[model samples]
Target: MSDVWTWPARIGVLLGAGLFLALLVPILVIQIRRYGTTSPARLLGAAALAVYGTALVAYTLLPLPSGDLAAWCAEYGYPTVQLRPGQIFADIRERTAGLPLGAVVRDISVLQGVFNVVLFVPWGILVRRYLGWGLLASAASALGASLLIEVVQATGVFGLIPCSYRLADVDDLVTNTVGGVLGALIAPWVLRWMPRAKTLAATRGEPRPVTVWRRWLGMAVDAVAYTTLSGLLAMAWGLVGYLGTGQVPPDTVPLWLFASVLSWVVVFVLPLATGTGESLGQRTVWLAVVPDVSRVADGGVGLSWSARLRRGLAGGALWGLLQVLSDAATMFDVGALASASNLASWFAAVLVVAVPFTAGKRGLSGRAAPYRLADAREGAGALSTHR
Candidate 1:
């Protein structure tokens, strides 16, 4: 079976999932929050506004200047590493000085520049919505923000990450800013591409604007609840292990307590809790319940169960185990923002891999597919139902 799917396909699957979330989360949020108040036209407009607004605010409010970012980079264990852009470029230039112009651009530095641009696409979408700005605005804001962050890092205000962080490259500024603008402009077309998502409007009662704190709380509650399920399952595992071998793995911790903490974190800190509502934990929480209702041409009631079963099975007990395994693999690999220690990577890995099934109903499988939430409203609704 594994042979049937090449590594490229497997990698594509992972990348595709990430890309989907990156593209969908913004629009889904817009539809969920704004659709209820105005026409679908206005709703989308509002969503676009919110996305860009949030991005701008995030850029401004980011704690880069606190200088703690530098110290935060190296907390991971042995074999911890940092990516030095300037050093990498210098090495590249020295090694490939004789290469053709095309080859030079194809080298590591150029490739990294391209990725830097890609990494900030979400920023563009966000900036445009937040500030009523376009691609140029988004790009300008992104460059300014990145530069601020780099300056802070160079200053070592936040700590070690700042210390080892590289040059504030002009190229990075150019690429990242352009990426942001493209994202902003791309938003409307992207939403139009989706099959029309049924949205609630003021007619049904204007959906409350989701506050940052409330959104976070909702996620927190779901995380705790899901983790509880994991705990129960863990107990079942322990009981079976005992029945079969009359022994327990000393290396293992108590399931009840561990799941409790994990679920708690899933709720409070995951990105989904903040907006996307598609964090590994949040996604599982969403799968347990059905989304909103609507009518057919004849006004027949219906349910959008397109991905529900997938969500459910993925969020199930066995799937939870797989979630943990995948997360463990993706931890260091997913977002490796290492301070000197690489603690963030380790923690992220442990959380992604072990957190779900070890204590709750959601696992790696659910996370792999995640909950297909479109906005904060749907996310909240999903959380309520998932529990």
Candidate 2:
């Protein structure tokens, strides 16, 4: 059946289109090498390509209104800047209203199960083929993935990633697990029924393919790229202000300083989120403070919404207050415009800023998600060798 094309569908189509087009070259090569590129095989090959292409195009054309949904939620102040745990459940209840009722229709209408089961068909294909995990493992992975998408929407997009937003509700978890099972059960047949097609499902490498620390290091490299970009922006701003103003304005200098400090928070620091806001940096570099060895065995970082909130409040409040004090001190001037008291206060504030980086477990980097990255190349290098 043809799909109702939407903007997201178009984007999804474009992404897969390049790969599908690439597949055409392989068919020609396979035909030339094996047979004389004759009528039946060529026709069959062309038919297979057409079917695969149709499935992909149709999948891309589906009316998955994710962006519109997010915008709609945003219009209602759903993801408020500040939030609480209860609101999380409230959102679940609300989003639950329009959930696809495929499971409910299974008794009388088998066709409905097609829609219900098909909704998460990829989850099964992913787990069984790529992840090579069992039913529970597949369910857990799906739950984690779905919860993460919600959390990112809440925290990064909406800025309302509250405890509930960060959490996977019991209802949603069960529903999502069931959806995953449905998908898995339906996947083998989906592949079989795909009209003379050979589709290889791929996944984000985890087990024997890529080690955790290596992935962690790659994340660190991305952080460095972000930092470098921030630095270049700062440099350009300084040059532009100097050229336009004829002389660097007094305010221009301070803005640069502030940008320099804050840029660290935006780029290198935000990636280390451990569901509870204890970043990878804090977990590894400041391991003495966050004590996240348990997260390692759990196989992922950041789970509990409460933990994230606590870490964010404690770390953020402490860090923000300290930096503000520094700003105040930096701007302060004595009666003579050169008071020793002011100078001393500024120095004291500067020293105080280091307190978080040295706090309990010294998980106090307060630099946000950047701790592990800053230290791994230096500290963990010697430590990792023993492993």
Candidate 3:
């Protein structure tokens, strides 16, 4: 019982909570980016799984035992195994019979029994709610999990150590399985707080709001592709400079200008070649850039090519401007001013990443221009002036 309240044990619990938060944040971002919405139930479900895993590791492996197998053999004798069932129960009964109720309740063996059952209860709830496992299946899984833990302990962590430091007890299996069953029984009441399957599938075949995450993902893909193209072009320019003047490239403004032009064409013009407005990230994440006709014309059904070109250029110019500023910021010498510039550069990067979240689905560039970014799958409906 003292071991549970020790500093090490408390740290383990804190780590488990941290793990829960760590898992939740990324999951929320991914969900918003891909689905334009998230299920709170799913996020909590994932957090529960992470906490459970952390707890499992803490109990099984933390506060490692001391002394090597050879040392133990010389001092206490060779390694041994305990295969008899009911021996723990028999010993507990014999030891507690003469003791008072308070003493019996305070015993470490009794406390361990309670801990084993409590530890596995969450597993049952998580499996039932997330994996959709039935009562019997969860119980079987609990038993299998307990068996694996016991097997590893009995084998001295599969020969890493000389002998078993922890005892492989049959009582743990019974308590853990019961805990799992108990959790499954309570899942029905707890599941009401989570999102339903229908809600999750709502955007499966419908036009969803283009989220900031989606836009950022598209930007990331485009950035990589643009950088690769820029690098090749820069190498060519450097080679030409060497051939002409027998020296390295004298000016990089041309390279930056060329890269910006290439970026604009790739982002705005190349989409025309593919016959789809989706960049690589948008394609992978099932998002598309389409014009919102209602905002484009006074009472028209679709946007003209001129409107799209203006919208594209508006967004592309800002992106190119930001890129050039970021590049220039990197060339500064190490000093207070340089640090401030770097901080501003980081702020700019953060602003770029965060703009979509604040600008709604239209994003910064689209909101600044006459075009609206929407689901590409809207097909003919996208071109109609239907708000």
The lDDT per prediction is 0.45, 0.42, 0.63
Per-residue CA lDDT of candidate 1, range 285-316, in tens?
22222232221233322222433334333333
Q: In model 1, where is the ten-residue run with the lowest total lDDT?
A: 287-296
Best by TM-score: 3
lDDT of 2 by residue, 258-310 (tens): 55445545543464342334343332222212224333444343334444444
Off by over 4 Å in 1: 1-98, 126-137, 160-162, 194-387
Model 3 misses residue 205 by how many Å? Answer: 3.3
Report the C-alpha displacement of residue 101, candidate 2, in angstroms: 13
TM-score, predicted candidate 1 vs. hidden true structure:
0.32
What TM-score would each prediction reach against the true structure? Answer: 0.32, 0.28, 0.65
Q: Using TM-score as the measure, name the better of candidate 1 and candidate 3.
A: 3
Candidate 2: segments with Cα more than 4 A from true spot: 1-5, 19-74, 79-117, 158-173, 192-387
Candidate 2 TM-score, C-alpha based: 0.28
